[model samples]
Target: MKLNTIAALMALAGICSVGVAAELAEDPEAIRLRIGTGDPVAGKAKSESELCQGCHGEEGVSNVVGVPNLAAQFAPYLIKQLSDFRTQSRRHRIMNAMAEGLSETDLPDIAAYFASRSRPKEDGAGGPDANAKDLFLYGDVERNLDACASCHESDARGRVSRGVAYPALAGQQSGYLRVQLLNWKAGIRNNSPQGVMNRVASQLTEAEISELANYLSGL
Candidate 1:
């Protein structure tokens, strides 16, 4: 990216109030998650009329235990998931029905509205146990497990990999995260980049899943 473009991205990051650093411009695989995103103002009105707020709170905080929070999540990721739901690729009945009625623009619009909010508050879990911390910060070499930060970042804010914006995991619902991890481990959910999630989750015991979820949700 040109210096001017990088500066402009920084300025837009401020306007969006997202936690993106201009250095991401230099990463071949990293693209700002909000680049060319939809208008949040329009999205708010759309989400309300479409009843999207019934489950995901008006502020994008999830009210249900298994549902994921969307506040300050990556817009690109939101768009991709919604697109998948529409195509039935991700396979959720309610999501598919809801997404089916949406026009093409509605996808990005809704994503923008949710992404416009700041991250949700901590889940009150405080911090991860030592085992979870170890797994996240430093993978077990004996197990050939890669550190969670290799993709999700140490802060769990996520990072762009191969132009894919890994969803932010910090402040995500523990139940939701656990279920996804379990699904990956069991090969029930198989959309992760390069099958990495499946490989990584397969290495985790159930206790480790709970431990990681508890720690990440607290962030």
Candidate 2:
């Protein structure tokens, strides 16, 4: 494992299931000093200076329907997305323009800042229905699919390992999730690690994607 990931895991050691990163978000400078990421404080300032909060909202949640919430997202995932944007591996006109201004130091710090925000509020749409739950918890074996939780963790709170972090899906915008899944299925988006999303999405029907998105958004 990378040294920074080790430190992060050590920080997580013995902590309750509530999560250690959530507590560290507010003032992560202390722990961040020893990590590959950056200071949340600086990230907050830079985010504002760059007007990130304008669309992403004050606390990393988005006001727009299709815009994804960034609150409490894993810094590693956020950093990777930004890096992808800068490299055009993940293409988005607005995101690409926005990412161009960030320095290398700014990337992780900004990611850390968003990671510091609290998780997005859950929609009161009730929990996932049977089909959605089954797909999320245990994907169809006959289809050779992996359960969503296998990578995203329970309730899609996200997962972390070694030096990688998967993004949290709970309380994310259903619209955004649906769009992304569709993009993956259509090969419009191919930036996922090891093409995992591409493969998973290819097997999903439109109805299944919608069901899955709705299921995760309320989580």
**Model 2 score (lDDT):** 0.78
Estimate, for each residue in 1-219, the C-alpha lDDT of model 1 and write its tens digit: 243453354355453343333333444233335433576667778989999998998878888878889886887889888888888878787999999999998988788777756677564663748888889889889999999987788888776567787888889888888899999899988777778999999999998999898888988
Strongest candidate by lDDT: 2
Whole-model alpha-carbon lDDT for candidate 1: 0.77
TM-score of each: 0.83, 0.84
**Poorest stretch of ten by lDDT in candidate 1:** 15-24
List the pairs of residues colliding in candidate 1.
none
Which candidate achieves the best TM-score against the true structure?
Answer: 2
Report the C-alpha lDDT of model 2 over 15-78, residue by residue, as the tens digit. Answer: 1124435455544543342233566666777889988899898678898877889977888888
lDDT of each: 0.77, 0.78
TM-score of 2: 0.84
Q: Give candidate 1 regions above 4 Å deviation.
A: 1-32
